[model samples]
Target: MRRTLLALLLALPLAAQAAAPSALKAEDVPSLLKPPAHGVRVLALWSLDCAYCESNLQALLKLQRAHPREIELIAVATDSVAQQDALAQRLHAAGVDALPARAYAEDTPDRINYLLDPDWGGELPRTLIIRADGKRSGISGQLTPDKLATIAP
Candidate 1:
C-alpha cells in the first residue's frame, strides 16, 4: 500500500502537466481572431520570459472572473512547444489553468505574431480584443484597468 500510494503521488503531477496548453500554430491564429458568436474575446499573447506578462495575465483573468458572461479570455503563450512545461507551470501558478490557453507550435514565433497583428512587432504581453460586433483592437505592454475596461465595458 505504501509503494502504491507513493507511485500515485508521483504520477499525479505528470498527469496534471499532461493537460498543458494545446499548440497554436500559424494557421490557428486566424480562427482565434474571429469574433466570438457572443460576448467579447480577449486574446492575450504572452511569453514566459516577459517581465510583465504574469501580472497582465492575472489582471485579465480577474476581469474575466468579474464579467464571465461578457468576456471570453484566451491566453496564448508565444513560447514554442519546447517551453510548454514552463508555460504550463506559470499558468497554473497564476490560477489561470482553467482558461482556454495555447502554446506556440510553429517553427518561428514571428509567423504567429504576424498573424495576430501586423503591427505587433513581436512584442511581449500583447492583447487582442474582439467584440461581438467584429471590431478589434490590439494593445501591447502591461494592460491597466483602463485598458481592461475597453474590452470588459
Candidate 2:
C-alpha cells in the first residue's frame, strides 16, 4: 500500500505538468486564422483579468460540446507564458483544460494581438471564427447566444 501511495504521489506532479498550455508565439499567430479542411474553428482569445472571459470560454465550450464534430475549440490566453500556472488553473476551473490552449510566449503582445486581428487593439475575450471555406469574423466582447450561433459548425 505504501508503494502504491508513493507512486500516486509521484504521478501528481507529472499530471500537473502535462496540463500546462502550449506557448503561443508571434509567428504562429498568422496560421491561427487558416481555415481548417473540416469543421469550424473557434479561436477564443482571453486574458486573466477579463471579467467576462470565463463566461465566454464556457459558452464556447458548450457550443463545441453540442457540435463536437462540427466545432473545434482553440483557446488562447493572452497572458504571458510566465503566468502559465495561473492560466492553467483558470482553464481547468472553467472545465476547458481539455481543449487545445496556448499562452502568449513573446515579449510583444501587441504584435500578437495585431496578427490575430488588426482592429482588435488587444481587447479581452476576443473570439475569432474561422470557417472551412476561408471565411472569418472577429468579436471583441463576450460572446452572446446570437454570436455563438453564427459559428455553429
User: Which prediction has the highest TM-score against the true structure?
Assistant: 2
In candidate 1, position 103 carries an lDDT of 91
lDDT of 1 by residue, 83-151 (tens): 777888888888777788899898877777888888788887899998888988898899887887887
In candidate 2 the C-alpha lDDT for residue 146 amounts to 88
Best by lDDT: 2
What stretches of model 2 exceed 4 Å from their correct place? 1-7
Please give the lDDT score at residue 152 for candidate 2.
Answer: 92
Per-residue CA lDDT of model 2 for 1-153, tens digit only, reads 999999999998786676678899988877888888898888999989999999999999899999999998999998998997898889888887878888899998888888888878787888988899988888889888888888897
Q: Please give the RMSD of candidate 2 to the true structure.
A: 1.6
State, as a TM-score between 0 and 1, how close model 2 is to the true structure: 0.91
